[model samples]
Target: MSTKEFIKNQVEKFSSHITPEEFADLTEAENSLIILEVPSKDYTLTEIARIIESNNAHVMSLSVLPVSDGSTLLISIKLDISDLTPVLRSFERFNYNVIYYYMKEGEINDIQRERLQELLFYLNM
Candidate 1:
């Protein structure tokens, strides 16, 4: 089976056990989560870590789930940094198939926050 098919099958099974809110809560944690697929022959923990480190990030935890087809493995990684934009781009540049990723929503930008504060002061609410 192709990699996509295997990944799809696994995700389907996994989704049945968790609701969207539950899943969101899981991803909204301090650490970011990334799910990728790699050919069994090309899988290497060191290589993945090196790639993440290149973006000044570190992997908090990693789990490897072997597909039933035995051709590709799904790599689930939790990163210490919540901003996943840089890490996602780095993985794409390296040609890794990023199947899923979740980053906790960032707070309002400084300018936006300041504007809101000024408005609130005027309203005195």
Candidate 2:
């Protein structure tokens, strides 16, 4: 098999152990960057802003990445708690490519790092 397949296969073999402490670390505000993947062509800033306001969140920073298939947007929200479920559910109504993350602050252990690397591969980032 190819190296990519090999790595994915190996990554699937290991189970991740995330403690409450680790989960807390993931939601910590200091060094987290929230990733939002959405369809860029049909989406406007107004729609994005509406979604944020509807969910009672405000945007701090926004970055847009264009790809052949579709575009992905990264938003840094200055939120007390990094809760993405509401925002994601609201965005789903528009039928866009969506996923989110609050980037971990401290050094990512091997498993977390590997999972992120796998994400990069899948997203072609």
Candidate 3:
């Protein structure tokens, strides 16, 4: 199945109350969101959030994925475009292996946005 279909299934399983349309709206509102994927072995979700918070960035959502090698934490944070530099520097200081992506305002595509919305909804609950 496609990623969107997978997410829809997961959402249905986790939060049947949230409709597709509502998820869309939630993602739309979070256009300024940044996603960070960090290996769980390097840092726990709380530690990562604390690190981000120390740099003045707010973690809006966090989730974990377990794999054969190890787990990975997926986090969504709200931050200004300009604050990216310092936050990244902090990550480096902490020696975290992180992969990240973000879109400019009005630039988010449907699938990407929906996935983030599903993640936020899933993690929140």
Candidate 4:
């Protein structure tokens, strides 16, 4: 399946327990954010954020999932298309293992965009 389709499926699957409105909110957050599953042993979320920020990217949110060996981090970052390469390279320079799967803001659909706007509105309220 295509990346968008995969993302949609993942969102739907993960949001099943929530109400429709909550699901929409979760989907919007997922769409607007780029998800990075970074293994924790290499770098902490703060270090990753600092590395990205130094390279001119902005991190919006961060979470961690504990695993057996280390941990996995879910990071949402904002970066211009042009800055993607440099930011990725910076991660490599630090020997950070960034998982291949990720979502980009531009990949989100219109419905997701509307949801994102709504979610942002609620956050600002």
Q: For each predicted model, how many residue pairs clash, with residues at least 3 apart or on different chains?
A: 0, 0, 0, 0
Q: Which stretches of candidate 2 lie over 4 Å from their true place?
A: 1-33, 68-81, 103-125
Candidate 2: count the clashes. 0
lDDT of 4 by residue, 27-75 (tens): 4433222345566655465787788778666664444444344455444
Q: Which candidate is the best by lDDT?
A: 1
Cα displacement (Å) at residue 114, model 3: 35
Question: For residues 1-125, what per-residue lDDT tens digits would candidate 2 score against the true structure?
Answer: 43334333322321125443364465443223344555555757787778766877666545554444445333333333355556656767766544444433332355578998999999995
**Ranking 1 against 2 by lDDT, winner:** 1
TM-score of each: 0.62, 0.45, 0.45, 0.44
- Candidates in order have lDDT scores of 0.73, 0.50, 0.53, 0.52
lDDT tens digits, residues 14-124, model 3? 334865335444553332344455676665667777777787666554444443455655544544332355566677788765455443433235556899999999999
Better-scoring candidate (TM-score), 2 or 4? 2
In model 2, residue pairs whose N, Cα or C atoms come closer than 3 Å (at least 3 residues apart or on different chains), thus clashing, are none
Candidate 1 structure, TM-score to reference = 0.62
Give the Cα error of residue 107 in candidate 1, in Å.
12
By TM-score, the best candidate is 1
lDDT of 3: 0.53
